[model samples]
Target: MKNVSRVFYITLALVIITVIFGAAFPAQFEGITGSIKSYVATTFGWYYLLLMSALVIVAVSISISPWGKIRLGKDGEKPEFSLPTWTAMLFSAGMGIGLVFYGAAEPLFHYLSDSPTAETGSGKAFKEGLVYAYYHWGIHVWAMYGVTALALAFFQFRKGEPGLISTTLKPLFGDKMNGPLGTLIDVLAVFATVFGVATSLGFGAVQINGGLSHLFDVEVGFTSQFFIITVVTLLFLVSAWTGLSKGIKYLSNTNLVLSVVLLVLVLIIGPTILILNMFTETFGMYIQNFIEISFRTAPLESDNRSWLDSWTIFYWAWWVSWAPFVGMFIARVSRGRTIRQFLTGVLTIPTLLVSIWFAVFGTTSGNIQNNGTELTQYATELVLFNMFDQLPLSLILSLLAIVLIGSFFITSADSATFVLGMQSTNGSLLPANRIKIVWGLAQSSVALILLYVGGLQAIQNTIIAAALPFSFVMILMVIALFKALNEEHKKMEAEEEKKQNS
Candidate 1:
């Protein structure tokens, strides 16, 4: 009880201080966050790239190795959730809000801004834009989640360890895991999860506000967005109170249905053929240039390096920040499955859905741009709403989009609260409702404060800064997981030999 209290209050105090400082001195807060983000990106960009690449390789290798057949839990244990429910929850928690927020906007931004490496406003630029968008939302991001979740699941279920990020490193640290080092690791995990989820909540609020303004003429500003965040925070807190199966699972399944309906509507009403063609060509291009793009570091061109830092490096950090929250939630729902099944499902299904999402919304927006819509005229938050305005049944579809975003926001927050509770309560699978409520409120408060002070840029900078230390932790986690798995394999071999001799 004392340990739990210490973790909760210490994390709470740190978050409160940061939020208060940010709210009271907006300019100073922004300057500090911005400077930290810039320093991390400039000095550590190469490391971030290498880390992501290594994670991808590790994820794929683990899925194919003999260890892949090992169940996350005891041998012969079956999966807890059905395939569809599992996929829905993972997708909703992982990147549902981000996809809705950036699907059309990112592609359009790339199209308009043009790449430093690609020609401006030409056929090559179009391909480069889509490829870059795909790259940002591709397997690399899921690979981060995959590796982290795999570590947590293996340690928790197979080894009977607590379901905490620090616990996963027990093989490396042994008894020290019960000391300050372990507590600090868990604290950093909670910090990363809070800010990462808060960043998404901030984005969701901006987009929700933009949708309301487009439909009902409500002004889009800090006040309106703050109200949106408040309302969303309440909704998600209520959902978290209901616990995972009743609140989060149902909402996640609903999110998936609504998302498919929206996708089909856009495809049927928009240029169906063109969207399909673009998807095929862009997918091929993404595959053909996957390695080059993944490892590309613009060492020769300052402009290209800046662009990479802003887009690619920033995205890597964001995904790494999200790994702890998403990974733990995934591990909770992934008991009784083999490492192979978990990795395959986590890596493939979401990536495919994201690609299709980018194809439908991104290509449709680009087509609108080609027809002189000037998508860049609107704010980034308003791009999705504006894109929907051009489709048939604009008002109804826009309302549906808002609902989807709202649901995504709730589901993501609920999952984050659950994960934070587990981390704070020493890896309890079912954390107390009070813990959930506190974390839920803290996440929303951070989002609201950041939105009020520095808007989306502040949120972005915070995520990058918070994720930097956690990225190193994730690398260590991978090493620790490999060591544990090797021991397990050797023990199994020795047991088999003894049985045969007997």
Candidate 2:
């Protein structure tokens, strides 16, 4: 308790101080953050690609190997939540707001943007657009989450260790995880989780404000965004007070249903056949070109290299930043499941849903673009609402979309609070309510500060910068987890031998 409290307060003080500095000196902060982000991306672009690829390989290998049978908890334990509910929570916490925000915008951007290998506004460009969208949102990002979640679940559940990111590396470090090094690691995890989720919260607030403006004639600016953030933060804190099983679970379930309804409405009222065909063709292209797309840095082509850094590198960094929060939440909800089942669920389900979502929304937007409607002319944040305008019952669907985004905002914020509390409280499965509330407010404050500092782009640059060091942390975690798993396997084998001898 003493150690957890000390770490929690230290982390809280550091985060508050940083946010204050950023808010007070917005230009200086953005300059520093932006420089660091560019340096990391330009220098280590290949490293990010290689590391992400290795993570995917490791996750897949572990799932298919004999280790697949190893339960995250005890051998006889079953899953905590049913498949459907569990999947809902995973999607909600993982990338619910992102999918909604970018489903229409990303594909359209890719379609219109210049590409080195594909000509803009051509058939190849359209295919490449959806393909890249899948590449960004697909197995790689989930694998990053899966590896971290698997390590945490194994150490915390199976081995009876604390849920801190440092604790997962206890196999290699032994007691050092209890020392200053461990404190540093845990502090970094908290920082990463808070900023990562704050970035999402900032996005949610902007999009929600945009939705309101589109639907209700409300104004759109910092005032509207701040108001949305304030109100939604209170809602999430109250939801956090209700605890995970009731508050988060119910919201996640509702989010999934509403999301599905929106997707269905878009499909039915939009070009239904075109979306279906786009899904089939896009899925095929994504699978076929997955490897090339994953490793393409446009090394020889400077212009294409710039585009790669802006889009693909940024996405990888964003996902890595998010791994701690999403990974811990997934680990919390994924107790008593086998490695195979966990990987399958995390990697497959959400990727498929994202693909379908991008197909429907992306293709519909593309159709509008082709018809001279020029969907991309609107701001990226407003593109989703604009696409909604083209369909039947635009008003109702737009309102529902706002409700869905707000629900996702609350769920994501509350989940981060829970994860942050757990990380700060020595990985207690049920962290104290006071801690949850404190972190909840802190997360909202960071978002509010970032909004004032430089809005969405500033939030993104901060996330990419923060994610740099943690990417190395994730790599070390993979090594430690593999070592621990191997030791566990040997111990199990020795126990079996002893029983036979007896």
Candidate 3:
């Protein structure tokens, strides 16, 4: 509370107001958010596609260019965290609970319920389904995250600037970034972060309830989920107040180990051979059709366009909305690596790992469906748990998955608390604990309200709508980063030439 910035007050006020309105008039809140989601998908589908593609290209270019050698910190400084630890943090911040929630259900849906292009329930749909899941959770999301994270890391560690998003624009905006415009930018970022984290929290609570209700005799409604969120909220708040290396690092490493164990067991138990084959085929298809799908809008085909609206457009917006929180958190954990190493690790490692996770789960689920089990008839949150039920050691696997979700839930919320606190107080490395607690409550309240209003759908609609403004901010961030990187590279060249002359 001592070092809190005005951004905190304004953002808090905005979020409180939103929660009040949502709580007071749940129907209107849901209706307005749904309209915004539809409008964004229909009106700016092309813009999202292009913006995401450019971000990926920009991230790739930075990794391969001469500027890649620029260290995120002052020259000669070593990274604060070890390689494995850093990677774990990156993996955790990147996509913890989501992979669990949508890991299998997405592909199963595409193959059975709504094929992207192929006839529903056809072989082509089965194959194409995995490819689209790979596309959505693939390099595009990480690239957008990498570039934004790179910008923040370069400016904060190397230039010794504050870690706020607006500070990255100094090369473009100069002193104006320290003014009202900058405050607006930071507030918007905090607002987006709130929703992004809240959505994940909502998903985590619901899915945890889904797992419990499936495994135990628990009920499957807001009452159970409400308690789940309450318990996890207190747990994560404790972890959040603990310093990063102590709390987050341990939880994330645990998440990685649990994730690997679950993946291996499912691969062996579900459909081992088919998982590998699906991986090989879809990896190739994803690469081959990557460019076409990157720019595809399908204006002539209403069916395809509608699919794009629901899946692709929504995904693009989700990633952009998530970019700030992911970017800032990754930047915090990625302080000492060079630009090249940073971007390479960010763009490649997570993308590959996520693709494999999806392949294993997606392939296994597809196999189950093809075998005559109508898994799609179940709720989305219960799909993965039910899939586990069909495998060996079903009870143990279900328990492990619940623990994994719980850990990921805590880790994600932990990261969010710190990011929110940092952004709120002008990027303070050690934001006051009270401020974090307030934010923790704020985030949890938002998630609970969303659950009350419209559950998972309300979460999705809110995110799609929240992402639109931040997408423009992301564009500005890329421009600012490029300008700064180019100017710095020129200075490096001039100094190198001067050294030769001397």
For all candidates in order, the CA lDDT equals: 0.90, 0.89, 0.90
TM-scores vs. true structure, each candidate? 0.98, 0.98, 0.99
**Regions of model 3 farther than 4 Å from truth:** none
| TM-score for candidate 1, residues paired by index | 0.98
What's the lDDT for candidate 1?
A: 0.90
lDDT-sorted candidate list, best first: 3, 1, 2
Residue-level lDDT tens digits of model 2 in 1-502: 4335456988899999988898789999888888888888899899899989999899999999878878999989999999999999999999988888898999988888655367889988887788889989999999999999999999989999888899988888889999999989888888888899999999999999888888778998889988999999889999999998999999999999999999999999999999899899989998897788778877885457877888888889889988989999999999999999999888899899999999998999998889878787788889988988877898988888888899999999999999998988888878888889899989989998888888887887888888888999998999998888888888878988999999
Per-residue lDDT, model 3, residue 230, is 98
The per-prediction tally of clashing pairs is 0, 0, 0
**All candidates: CA RMSD (Å):** 1.3, 1.4, 1.0
Worst 10 residues of 2 by lDDT: 1-10
Worst window of 10 by summed lDDT in candidate 3? 297-306
lDDT of 1 by residue, 19-68 (tens): 89998999999999999999998899989999998999999999999878
lDDT tens digits by residue: candidate 3, 332-354: 99888999989999888888989
- Candidate with top lDDT is 3
Best by TM-score: 3
